[model samples]
Target: MSPVFSASAEIDDGHLHVLITGEVDMATADTMFQAVLREPAERVTLDLRAVTFFDSAAIHAVVRLAQQFPGALTVLPSRQVHRVLDISGLGDQAWLRPA
Candidate 1:
């Protein structure tokens, strides 16, 4: 089956905010990944409050983004999203901030 997902982005005050919804898995990682990386900004915040599902591939994409931006990535996640991040072993990642 195909992964059900969609992403939208907006720029505000020199920052990029990306909102991702649905399942972020192998099938949807490339688009999601590229969308966030397509533009450069002073900071990038990924809002995952509406994400219903997220897999390891999505986790990897976030990791790559963190590595590329260093202290420039922040993630806003709901409690459910936090569980997914925790289960995927990113709960303790220093750069993965919750806001």
Candidate 2:
């Protein structure tokens, strides 16, 4: 099993930067979602480059964040994240930034 999920957030100027590491699974996706929701900003940069594991529930959390911020959301995905996004057919979403 991967390490337990962890996340941190900070705001600079009008951008909210969220960094997530460890496993993002059914047990942790909701916590990840709520962490981002707590910081409302004109722009959001989600850094998932350190994610060791990713799952469908985590994908739902990411999609919900995209819906919440739309064009203002940018995701930096790790290899794990990219694989699942590709499998889920969301790899081409406009919010994704090359990782």
Candidate 3:
């Protein structure tokens, strides 16, 4: 079995930066969802550079996160991670920017 996903967040210069690791799937997507949205922030940056795996559920969670902050949510997705976003139509959303 895979290790449970883990995430941490910090506010830097008015932007919330969340670092995530492990697999983010149906079982763990909500954790990232709650961790990020529970706090009110003008902007959010999800650091998915360390995430080794992610599924459609994870993509949905990120879409929701994007809705919460609209144009203020930036995503730092690994090269492998970008494909999912592109397919999900999230990559086309003006609200989501890849870094």
Candidate 4:
């Protein structure tokens, strides 16, 4: 079966806010990544509190976006996302914040 997923993005005051729900594996990583990167913004907030799965691809996408945005990206991670990122040693990044 297909992985469940949905993503929405909005820009306000030069900040891009993206909300994502569902699985974030290879199949949906690009979708989430593109949604957050589609527009130009001075800052970005990625909300993943409803995400159920976060795989390696999702981690890669997050890393890439973090690199692209530098100190301008913030991530609100769900339990699943926090677990994966913690295990992957990326949870210590300055951009991760409690939901």
Candidate 5:
């Protein structure tokens, strides 16, 4: 079966709440990346609680977005997602939250 991935964003409390679901592999990472790029908010919070699986591509996409936005991005990753961020050395970035 083909991997499924999707992301949606909403602005709340002066921040963009991005909800991501499904597996985040190379094929689907771009959808998440585009969602982040399209958000027009001062801050971004990514909710990854529903993400079942993720790969380096997803990690890199988040890192790239954080770099592009500087102090404007925040990641509210689930426990499992946190592990991937930790392994990618991106947990130390200022934008990563709930660490």
Candidate 6:
């Protein structure tokens, strides 16, 4: 079955806090992308604490956002997501973290 992904955003300390839930894949990446794009904040923190699975497309979405926003993207990913990011060579980026 295809995994589901959902995101919610809030403003905190002058930053955008995005909490992501479920799985992240091609099916759900666009929702996440749009959510972040719509939020008006200088800093964006993505909380992947509830994300159960992440694929290359999801990783690409994040990388692309990072590239677009530069130092404005911060990721708080679960251990599995963190491993995927590390394996995908996205760990070296200044925005992703293992949570």
Residue 36, model 5: lDDT of: 78
Instruction: Report the lDDT tens digits of candidate 5 across residue range 28-80.
Output: 88889888778677888888888888899999898888887798887878777
lDDT (C-alpha, whole model) for all candidates? 0.82, 0.90, 0.81, 0.94, 0.82, 0.85
Determine the C-alpha RMSD for candidate 2 after optimal superposition of all C-alphas: 1.0
Which runs in model 5 stand beyond 4 Å of their true positions? 1-3
lDDT of 3 by residue, 1-99 (tens): 865589998886778888888888998899999888766778888888777787999998987887778789888887656767787666766755563
**TM-scores for all predictions:** 0.85, 0.95, 0.84, 0.94, 0.85, 0.89
Among all windows of 10 consecutive residues in model 6, the one with the lowest summed lDDT is 90-99
Per-residue lDDT of candidate 1, residues 1-99 (tens digit): 644588999999889999888888888877888988888788998888777777788888888888887898888876667888888788887765563
Which prediction has more favorable lDDT, 1 or 3?
Answer: 1
TM-score of 3: 0.84
For every candidate in turn, the CA RMSD to the true structure comes to 2.4, 1.0, 2.1, 1.4, 2.1, 1.8
Write down the worst ten-residue block by lDDT for model 4: 1-10
Candidate 4 lDDT over 26-68, as tens digits, reads: 9999999999989999999999999999999999999999999
After superposition, the stretches of candidate 3 with alpha carbons farther than 4 Å from their true spots are 1-4, 95-99
lDDT of 1: 0.82
Better of 1 and 3 by TM-score: 1
lDDT score of model 6?
Answer: 0.85
Name the candidate, 4 or 5, with the larger lDDT value: 4
TM-score, structure 6 vs. true: 0.89
Candidate 2 lDDT (Cα, 0 to 1): 0.90
Candidate 1 matches the true fold with a TM-score of 0.85
